[model samples]
Target chain A: MISSIGRFIIGVFSSTGGVVILFLRTLYWVFIGPFQKKPVKLESVFYQMGFTGLRSVLIVFFVAIFTGIVLAMQTAYQLEKMGAVLYVASLVAISLCRELSPVLTALVVAGRVGSAISAELGTMKVTEQIEALEIMAINPVRFLVVPRFLALFFMLPCLTILGNLSGILGGFLVGVGSLNINPYLYLQTSFKYLELKDIYTGLTKSFVFAILIALVACFEGLNTTKGAEGVGRATTRTVVISFILIILADCVLTSIFYFSNM
Target chain B: MQRDYSQEAIISVRGVSKEFDGRKIIDNVSFDIYCGETFVIMGCSGSGKSTLLRLMTGAIKPTEGSIIIKGKDISKLRTYQLDELRKSFGMLFQYSALLDSLTVEDNVALPLREHTKLDEEIIKIIVKMKLSLVGLRGFEKYYPSQISGGMRKRVGLARAIALDPDIVFYDEPTSGLDPVVGGVIDKLIKDLSEKLLITSIVVTHDMQSVFRIADRVAMVHKGKLIQVGTPQEIKNSENPYIKQFINGLPQGPIDFFKEDIGILEEFI
Candidate 1:
């Protein structure tokens, strides 16, 4: 049992280490490659950001709102029996600000954006478009992955902020309307409990999660073997790996936050 | 052997060999492809013909020897340098390999967008001209999945000619087409080569295509070029392997099936 646990820990660290190495390599190539002197494909980047990021807003908003409402209902019902219903606002605010917003947004992005990245790139690799790019003296990583990585990196934090706001708004509606809590008091409590550190921590986690999703998806897509079967495998691996990494990073960040104050 | 009077050579391969997993695929292959000529590499299945093409195109490094493309040693070039060298050659794969997410115009414009400093308007014009060249002028908005195989091949041809590459590699360009479509593709290949004055290397077992399009045909057998001649010369050659291959005969140096007793008896 102990050996299995040790092996699991080692596996996680190694996978994360591999992702880190790929991220560093991507950054190195981005700065040093010849295309750095060329003007950025501003139009392409804007289109991709709109396609990959803006399209994701509806899903994130719905999930956050639903999660917040559900958590308020459950927490208010449970705490009311003990005359602690007022604390439900603090619970919802703290949870959404510190953990749920970033992690849930990542999960949603993994399902929506990460899968698309893997499939798009995997198909490109299969079709030899990547080879065509290389032959044309264009770096596939710069032409393809850099735009995607930048898109996710910039947008994940934005999404996380949107997610947190929507979640708190959902909690406010539930607390004031359904739970019969005062609106002004609920807002004051949520603000008092949710510190800047909590918001910063969640955004930091979101940024890391964004990097992890983009790196894993791009790496798997770039290295896809076999063909169509290989693409399906790469897509599955990207989502599963991203999901696990986001959750794990959330835990670590949460623990850091938990212990630092203690 | 006497050298045929023709245009100057653009690509020269000398003593090139490639091995995969300890198995020799292309061994001691040597040939020269001339400018503005349609050179066809013909061979039986599993005869290392495609491997030879890959080595010549710098898609894969040769295990031994060198391939010089227009006086540059491709094997000695660095990765980016190799990429720069490869810009001069266009490759059309057996599958059309059109990017599925991209429309036909975008697919055709990919090379221009990647390599040139041309404005979008000029790129679009060039793409239109290329598509019209391949007879795909109005299908610019369609994706690969939405098009038929022949249309896809036309789009592939359009993209192949996009950058006006000095050399074009067509790997079985007529493989999966009907004979009529295949003949049209053959005519297109011939016309395109003559019009652009570009070197073309077509790898196929299609005899009809060879006779229709090839300026010179080279037959590969057991990882060696057994014959390199004009189509007329190939037809008239008395080499047994060439005779057997061109005729599609089961007998001679090439085996059509295994000689296992049960299978042999069942066939009989």
Candidate 2:
């Protein structure tokens, strides 16, 4: 029994170590891969951007808007008791920019894009397509992982910015239409409480969260064993692990910004 | 044009062994494959024929001993060096391994595009030529999922031979095919080795494919080479395992039981 527990702990540590090595290798390729004789494909970068970013816009937008409404309505319900219902705008904006937009967007992307990445690469690994790539002398990391890393890194920030804006708009609609608050006063109050620092920190979190999702997904996918069942497991692990890591990272970054007053 | 199989060995494996989870898959195997010959490795399921092929191709490292390919010790080479050495090699996977996202032409064109500076026109011509070689001439725009299994295998062959490699490895070339389709593939393998003068290493359990295409055959039984000879010699082999395998017998040295389940227990 003790041996089994020891094996389990060793497995977890080794898996984590493998992921860190994969992450560092991917980062190295992302910077130096372009200078190689056969550079990483520019077209693949754009293709991943389309798949992971553009296709995700509508879903992210809708989720953000609804989250904003829920936040405003729930907070208004309480603020009314204190006769501070007009403060709903500041609450919604600050919450969206500081936490909801980045975290929720990452969670959604981790579910959609992260799982897709894992499934695709896992299928390739199982079917020997990755071996085929290696036999052809192409580095599968540069050929497969780098484009994905770049796509998420660049596009997640853009998605977060859009999500934040859509969320604020949703707050505006709920504040004026449902709560009967002044539109101009709500807008003024929203901007007054939401500073550039909030936007910067949120975008920064989104960027890091993007790297986390891509790295975890690619690592799980590349290390997939067995067959179809393994691919399914990898996809699930990508979403679950990405969610936990993103949330943990968000806590650390939020604390840093809080303590440093950035 | 006829070719000779008595040339110097192109690949030499010496006392190689591979283990997975302490289970021996390949054990102290040794052989030499000469240049410009279709060398077939024949074995029953779980005999490690596929694993041996992977080791030869440098896709997997052996646990002990050495595999020398074109005079370089494959196990000792760095990752990039192995990759550089792989430029001379091409492989057709058992399932074809065609990228589902790419069209037939693009799949065939991938290695050329990545490894060479040929003009797009030249690349298109070369892709067309390879497709023509594999009898996939007109299916260039179709995806892998859109093709029949035999056609997909041919497309895989086209992709594998796209770079005019000096050596090609075929893993179970006719495992899942009908007899007629398998015959066509067997004929293609023979013709390609002759026409291109490219060394061929085929891993299969198919007796007909071994007889039809192999200039030399290596019979593996439970991770050991029982015999290495021409097809006629293998057919004449008196070894019990070889006879059992080749004759398709129900009972012999090759046990059917996966585990030690008792006969009475199995029936119960």
Report, in order, each candidate's fnat. 0.46, 0.86
**How far in Å is the alpha carbon of B31 misplaced in model 1?**
1.6
Listed in order, the DockQ scores are 0.46, 0.85
Candidate 2, residue B247: the lDDT equals: 94
Q: What is the interface RMSD of each candidate, in Å?
A: 2.1, 0.7
Clashing pairs in 2: none
Of the candidates shown, which would achieve the greatest DockQ relative to the real structure? 2
- Candidate 2: residue B239 Cα off by (Å): 2.0
Error in Å for residue A57 of model 2:
0.6
Cα deviation of B220, candidate 1, in Å: 2.0
lDDT tens digits, residues B160-233, model 2? 88888989999999989999999989988988998998899999999988888988889998899899988888
- Model 1: residues >4 Å from true position, as ranges? A1-25, A34-36, A256-262, B1-8, B259-268
Model 1 scores what on Cα lDDT? 0.86
lDDT of 2 by residue, A96-188 (tens): 988999999999999999999999999999998999999998888999999999999999989998899999999899999999999999999
